[model samples]
Target: MKACIITIGNEILKGRTVNTNAAHIGKFLTSRGYEVERGITVKDNLDEIKWAIDESFGKYDIIVTSGGLGPTFDDMTVEGVSRALGLELVEDRETLEILSKRYKELSAELTPERLKLAYIPAGSHAIRNPVGAAPGIWISGGKSSILVLPGVPREMEAILDQADSLINKNDRFYYEATERLAGVMESAMAPIVNRIMEEHAGEVYVKTHPLKSETRNPEIDVEVSAYADSAEMAEQAVRDTIREILAEARRMGKK
Candidate 1:
């Protein structure tokens, strides 16, 4: 399955907060066999959020959004998503009950700000948050599914863990492999890598990372990753690319 991630917050845009949510979500989706297409961070503007949501619809099977689920004025993900989906914003009693119970357990009153957590787009279901007040929103779109999770890392992870059934039920797993070739320079191998990429085309990706080690000479790590319907096909594709690159490296006078 192809997926995209949108992180909504002005703090992230301003570099005031580290955007760890994208990396975490990317890793989670990758492990689930989802092909992550891209990750974007947008300000907490409803229009910008809605635009992103709309643009991603039909282009991806799943779109996950993090942040902007709090009770603060700048938390506008729900509103932006609702506008994008043409859904009316309404108070969900079930969510209200969940919030109310949690607050009562802590001997705190559910103030208006806290009550904001109870509102969601109509027809969407709330994914209970075991770690925080704002429950995640799960909305089924025309062609794509959306999961709006809280910005808090711990709470976001908890919600995702609880969503295994949904994610697995909708996605198909693909195989991917990575390899790092030592004692090579990326520039020297560029011609062969380019040829391999063109030869493989959509079947796989061959990338090079230049690295240095104090104890050894500068080297290039070549990572070959492929995605296919079957694990064997994916692994074999990567192995073939690795062999081809290594042969070219040897031909170019590498010992």
Candidate 2:
């Protein structure tokens, strides 16, 4: 399945907030054999968010969005999604009760702004946020599904974990392996990397990232990920690719 992640926040674009949510979601979904086609960070504008959702529906099988699910004025993710899908925005009774109970537990007021958290797209299945006021949402139509989670890291993690069954319904069982070379440069290994990509096209994904370290003259981390019918086959493919790359390094007089 192909996936698209939308991180809705102007802070992300301005470099004020790092988009760790996209990284986590990408890794989690890819492990289940979903190829993450794109990660987009959009401003908190309603039109922009709606445009992103509408565009994703046409191209991706699974669309996951994080952020813009707060009580503040800037929180407009739900509205954008509703407008994009032509769904009605209505207050969900269950979600309202959940939010009310949460606020009462903390001896806080269920203010008008806070009550706004209960509103969602008319037909969406509300997902409980174990750690926060806003609830996540899940909606499926035909062959596509969209999961909207909170911007908070802990809340997003909890909601995703809780809804694992729904997200992983189409299990594909993918695997990835990483090997770190203590004294290798990414530039020096480009040719070998290209050769590996050509030889194992569509069977394996090989990427090299250069790392700086005080203990080693140069370091390059090679990550190989592959999807196969069995875990053993996937693991062996990555191991074989790593071994081949290392052998090439040794032949070039790099220990």
Candidate 3:
């Protein structure tokens, strides 16, 4: 399965807050064998969020969006999702009731701001957030699915952990992993890695990201992934493949 993560918040873009939401979730999805196509952070502008959601459908099968689910006026993910799916924004009764209960639990009165958490797009399933007031929205498009999550890192993580069943039910994808290889040169390793990949083309990905340095020293980081039915199998494949590359490099050094 291919997925994209969109982290919504002007604060993230302005560097007021660290945008760890996308990066964290991307790693989560990647570790589950899903291919993460792109991870981006956009401002709270509904149009931009809508556009990103709409565009992600064309490029990825699943889109996981974070941020913009709160009682604040700036929380616009629900409306943005509505526009993306061509639906009307309406208060979901069940979600509203949940929010009301949360307020009561806190011995606080429900205000208009708190009620804002109840707005959900029509025809979308509400992802209940037991730990937070804002309920997330889940929608299915033609061939894509979108999940809107909270901006708070802890809340989003809580929902993700408790909602593993929902994620697993979405699609069937195999194993993939990425490791940082910061001490190698891509030019010196490309031919050998390519040869290994040619032997296992259908199930493995050998990606190298070269870190650009103004310093005289440079480093290339390599990430290896193997696709299989189980994590153990995939992990083993990656280890064995990496071992072969390392062994070959060692032998070459001796020659």
Candidate 4:
């Protein structure tokens, strides 16, 4: 299954906060064997969110959205989701009561605006919240399912962990991964990685994320992930690829 993640917030774009939700969710989904195709982060605008959702319908089997589920005016994730699906937002009394109880348990007051968290798009299934006020929404249609999770890191993590099995049970894939090599630049290593990928022909992904240091030279993460039928085959392919990459690195200055 193919999955895409959408992180919503202008803060992310403005660099006020790093958007870690995409990476977190992508890694989780990929570990379960799902093919995480793209992870996109967008501002809190309705048009952009709706456009992203609409465009992703035919391309992915699952779409996960995080952020913009707060009480403030700028928090319009639910509204954008409604617009994207051509649905209307209606208050869910049960959800509201649940939110109220949550606030009460925290020794806080639930204001009218806070109650708006219960107003979800019509025909959407509620994903129970154990750590936050805004409950996630689960909707399936057009050969895809979308999950709207709270933007709060802790809350999203809780939901993803507690509800992992039930979220998308049947959608899993196998990925073989191996990483090696230290001081190599991605641009310089791109041609070799590309050639190796072309030679393999199966679903493979090669990426390099460099780590910088002031006291020492930078080290690159030469990671290769591939998909196959069995764990053994995947492991062997990755091992062989790593050996080849290591040989090439040894020939160069990177050790």
Candidate 5:
């Protein structure tokens, strides 16, 4: 399956935030054997968020969004999704009850701002947030499914973990293996990686990263990965690719 991630927040676009949520979500989806095709970052504007969602809809099998799910005025992810899908924003009583109970425990009142967190796009279900008050939104219909999560890193991760079943509905598997070389340069490893990719073709992918500057003390790490319908197939493909890379590195007289 293919996936697209949308990060919504002025903080991310303005460089005020590092946008680690996108990276986390990408890695998470990739590990589940989903091909992450694109990642988009938009400001807190509703139109921008809606545009991002509209563009990604039907183009990808899964759409995961992070941020703008707070109680503040800038938190408009839910509304944007609602407008994009032409769905009404309806208040979920269970979500409201959860928010109310959470705030009461903190000796805080469920003000209007806090109350807004309970509203989600019609026909969507709320995924409970284990770390925050705003529940994540899950919308499934048509050709794609959307998972809208909070901007906060911990809350987003927690809710994503809780919604794993929704994302990884199949038994597909992903496996990756890496080998570090002491004196190999990225440029030198590139050819070997290319050959391994050609040999494996669609079964595996190989990439090399330079751990140290090639002009100085050169070191490289080769990563081989595969996604397959079975865990054994994925593992075997990655292992075979790794072995080929190591053998080629040894032939180059580099440790």
Candidate 6:
């Protein structure tokens, strides 16, 4: 399965806010066996968000978007998604009730701005946000699923935790193992990684990351990962690849 992450915020484009949501969503999906194929940053413009959604729907199995889900005027993620999917924006009564009760508890009036959070695309499920008021949106189409989350890192993570069943719809298993090598240059590890990848072919993938300057005390971290139909299979594939990598490093006279 493949996933695409769309971060909608002008703040992100202006470099005012780091897009930690995309990183978190990417890692979350990858651990569940979905390949994160793309990460897109779009301004709060409706057209850009719609375009990102349209482009990702058919190409990716899962589309996770963050930002613009608040009650403020700039929060238009729901509307953009509605337009892109051609779904009518309808008010979810349960969500409205929840919001109303929440505001009443705070001794605050439910203004139009606060009421706006209750509207979502027709036929979409609202995933409760554990840390915020705006509920996350979940839409399941033929082969794709869209998960709209709040931009706030804490709220996004909390909503995702509640959305485990929706996100883990597939049975594929993914496993990764990493080994740190001291005094081994990434330059030398590159060929070894390539060879291991070729030898394992579709079963495993190997990559090397240099931790220190190659000219000085060269240290590299080699990561081997695999995806399979079962957990045992994926784990065994990564284990085998890691063993091969260590053997190759020893042959090259690197500890």
**Candidate 2, overall lDDT?**
0.87
- Candidate 4 regions with alpha-carbon error over 4 angstroms: 103-110, 167-172, 182-192, 208-220, 247-255
Better of 3 and 5 by TM-score: 5
TM-score: model 2 vs. ground truth:
0.91
The predicted structure with the larger TM-score, 4 or 6, is 6
Reference-based lDDT, each prediction: 0.85, 0.87, 0.78, 0.79, 0.90, 0.91
lDDT of 6 at 68: 98
Residues 1-255 of candidate 3: C-alpha lDDT, one tens digit per residue:
888999999999999998888888887887666788888788999899988977777678778999998877888888887888888978899988887877898899889888888888777778778777777777766668787889999889877766566566433445544544444566766898788889989777787777755233546666777767776778788888777766876665621
> Tens digit of lDDT per residue, candidate 2, span 1-255?
889999999999999999999999998898877889998889999999999998888688899999999999999999999899989988999999888888898999999889888988887889988888889999876557999999999999999888788888455657787888877777788899999999999889889887875345888888888887677788888889888988998997875
| TM-score, candidate number 4 | 0.82
- Indicate the residue-level lDDT of 92 in model 6: 89
| Candidate 4 residue lDDT tens string, 21-46 | 88899888877677888888888888
Highest-lDDT candidate: 6
Better of 2 and 4 by lDDT: 2
Q: What would you estimate as the lDDT of candidate 3?
A: 0.78
Query: Residue 2 error for model 4, in Å?
Result: 1.8
Give the alpha carbon lDDT tens digit for every residue of 112-206 in model 1.
Answer: 88999999999888988987889998887569999999999999999988876777653344555555656666777788889889988989888
Name every residue pair that clashes in candidate 6: none
Q: lDDT order of candidates, best first?
A: 6, 5, 2, 1, 4, 3
lDDT per residue for candidate 6 within 1-255, as digits (tens), equals 999999999999999998888989988999998989999999888999999998988899899999999888789999999999999999989899999999999999999999999998999989887778999999987667899999999999999988888889669989998999998999978887887788789999888888999979999888888999999999999998888889989999997
Could you tally the backbone clashes for each prediction? 0, 0, 0, 1, 0, 0
lDDT of 2 at 27: 88
For residue 147, model 4's alpha carbon misses the true position, in angstroms, by 0.5
